[model samples]
Target: MKFKFVALVATAVAAQFVAPVASANDQLAQSICAYVADNNKNNLRKTLSDNRLRLKAVYDGISCDGLPLVRFAIKNNAADTAEFIIKQLPGSQVAQSGDIEWANSNGFAASPILEVIKARSAS
Candidate 1:
């Protein structure tokens, strides 16, 4: 009975520790999404810097409204953010992610961001 009580207490303590971490991650994601949606490039950079995260490192892990970071920026008409993201990532990553094709098919062909994507992918 004593062991069971100890285990239950331990589990409760562990859960308390975990909940805050999950909430912190959610808060970070929300902040990042807000920055991208608002087209606030400088704030985005500062947020990432504050978290000690690089765009390239966290790009694959972050999604805003079910869209990848660059895609979310484009969907929100956040051109500066999109361009900044494309510049941060490698050309091959951009090409492989199908961003160029998606942009063309989704009526974003005329966006200057497409040109930037192409320019980045070519190099």
Candidate 2:
């Protein structure tokens, strides 16, 4: 009976430890999304660089095909950061599709960068 009790306690503790690690991906995703929404490009970029935050994990959580991080940059008016994300995802379908559309619609404007994305996508 004591052995069984110990085993159960251990199992419970192990589950507690593992559960948050698994859910961290989603938490990180939401954090990234919120950061973008809040327009914190420096923090967003820093989080992206942190392996624990996991860019792919965040991307997976948001269902974003394009670099959603870039959307955050664009929203924040951080043109340089947005340009970086665009360069990173060159030739991506998200770049070709609604990412640019959303950016333009949201107030990024149809400037040279937006035009380039549209042109490349058109080609």
Q: Pick the candidate with the highest TM-score.
A: 1
Instruction: Give the total clashing residue pairs for model 2.
Output: 0
> How much is 51 displaced in model 1, in angstroms?
0.6
In candidate 2, which residue pairs clash?
none
Encode model 2's per-residue lDDT on 1-123: one tens digit a residue: 999999999999999999999798667777666666565667777878885554534453463224556565565655554554454454555454576778767777854457556654664
Clashing residue pairs in all predictions, respectively, total 0, 0
> Where does candidate 2 stray beyond 4 Å?
1-7, 22-58, 62-67, 111-113, 119-123
Best by lDDT: 1
10 residues in a row with least lDDT, candidate 1:
107-116
- Against the unseen true structure, what C-alpha lDDT does each candidate score? 0.89, 0.61
What is the per-residue lDDT of model 1 for residues 40-119, given as tens digits with 9 covering 90 to 100? 99999999999999889989989999999988887888999899999999889998988777877898777777888889
Cα RMSD to the true fold for all candidates: 1.1, 4.8
